[model samples]
Target: MNYEKRGGGSRSLPARVGRRLWVTAATALVLTAAVYTLSVRTVTGQRWENAVLAGRRQDETLAAARDANHMLDHVTVSSLGAAVAMLMLIGLARRRPALTAVAVGTVGIPLLLAEVLKRYVLSRPELVDAPARLSGNSFPSGHTTIAMSVLFGLALVVPYRLRGIAVGVCALWAISVGAYTVAAGWHRPSDTIGADLLVLAVACALAGLLARTGRVRPATERPSPLSALFLAPLCLVTLGGLGGGSLLLLESVVRLSPADPAVPRLAYAGGHALAAGASAAVTVVLLASLHRIDLDDPAASP
Candidate 1:
């Protein structure tokens, strides 16, 4: 397989990479702000999210709650340590220390940022007369952050050839975790969306750093088409089906009066579907952005 450099003539590789990175990071930041504003700072947003929480008892079965709890139980400090260790092992095995460091940063930075934003920087004001359970600030959920950061970290470190397979498998877990956060009433749909976007912004920034440092290169071999063929349609279908379904569900909620008996159930279902769709969209974005680039061997770089 032949790998070609990305630029020609006056345009430099680093320049191109940096431009793309800035654009993506800016977009993620704007989206994060939008999620916070629309979902946490607005009355309508608060009403719907609170309604979702209220409906959890009706929609979430005992077994389903248990399953969500069991899934969340896996997101402990020990598991994060193990995940970091595994990512480090991959970098060590490949003899790419820079890649390893970036991979670790990709995981650690978002987790820390999510905590800071949820705890200190951002706040959920008393925008609506909500229950005590729904009063606190829970944007950029820690559990969803952990799941997404780990998935993005794994995607960052895996070999180019295996990138699609690795992301495809891990995306399912990440997507499920995001949805489970809502299903368990631990987070709102926007919380999961915020986490996904935070991870994406950090990942893009780090990839840009790698490119600027000359630690990124074009792939030497073509990625397996089968992975794309399989994963692309899967993501598209998920995005379209769940996204469309959630819109319809939420549209009904919007049209109905707040006192209607069906509002809670509709909002809850819509929020759940929205959470899953957001995760799927994030996975697709990360895969598309990363599939073409390979981490350069540090020793081989000039």
Candidate 2:
């Protein structure tokens, strides 16, 4: 059933959309601040040495993982462009004008923001004193931001009934891309985390815009119990990933050895991968909730 109610009910659509926007904005701001603190203050001074060693170890680990590196090598701008073009094509073929809008907004805006922040807004402090020779600003990882934006955009445009699977696949894609960048030494764990938050903020803002403009679809059938069941395991996996990653990070930091940095470095990179996986899982869960709102109305029948 289509709902055109604007202000008649206390649980109106606008109010709910507004609430979501506020929460997203607040979370994004807090995360951005935390990232800045880590980049500028926490990782400098005595901790700089450890951070550099960990990064080099991550690079070494990636060098050993030939298969993983080879797979990630194929994820270039040209290929991603083609994938994005195909996503747009799917939206157009579906004849859903809103899908096209959502796709463009979700992918385009975050990409632009990622570039601007890396270039001008956020600065990568000289925290790593190693001879590893850092090239670009590494506040928010550009590769990660691009990968996640595309994944989230694709999930947003797909059919609601298919969204659960879409989210799962996209989460895996995000995890792989995130891990690849970390292992390649293109980014640190913090960079990946920042990029995730930036993309999420853009998506949330776009969703609020759509909801406010009355572009959201009407109430549909209630969500299936199986849908909820499907997401539970993913959430647990995310929790496991985060826990494992955090433990390794702690071990790496506490057991930092300048002479034999290999073990610590391995732990750091492995932890980063697990952290990335956890971040992906969280993103999937957030998007799934939004999909539920789009497809399932609690007030409606199953």
TM-score of each: 0.92, 0.80
- In the order shown, the candidates' Cα RMSDs to the true structure are 2.3, 4.6
TM-score of structure candidate 1: 0.92
lDDT per residue (tens digit) for residues 1-302 in model 1: 22333345212555566567767878999999998998899988888888888878788788999999999988899999999999999988988788888899999999999999988899988987867878988988999999989988988888898888778877888888999999998998899989989999998888778877666666667877767764775487477747774785667556645668788887887888888888888777777676566765453353
Candidate 2 at residue 25, lDDT? 52
Model 2: CA > 4 A from native: 2-11, 44-64, 132-136, 217-219, 222-233, 256-263, 266-270, 288-291, 295-302
lDDT of 1 at 98: 82
> Native-vs-model 2 lDDT?
0.64
| Model 2 Cα lDDT, one tens digit per residue, 1-302 | 33655345424664576467657756775876686576544554225324643555556654555755675777788977887897788777776666567777888888888888878977756554645445346767777887788877876676676666666666666777876676666666677777777877777777666555545544365544465665665677677767777676666666655665555565655446564764665476456447545621223321
Which candidate number would show the highest TM-score if scored against the true structure? 1
Q: lDDT of all predictions, in order shown?
A: 0.81, 0.64
Span of 10 residues, lowest total lDDT, candidate 1: 1-10
Q: What is the lDDT of residue 111 in candidate 2?
A: 81
Candidate 1 clashes: the total is 0
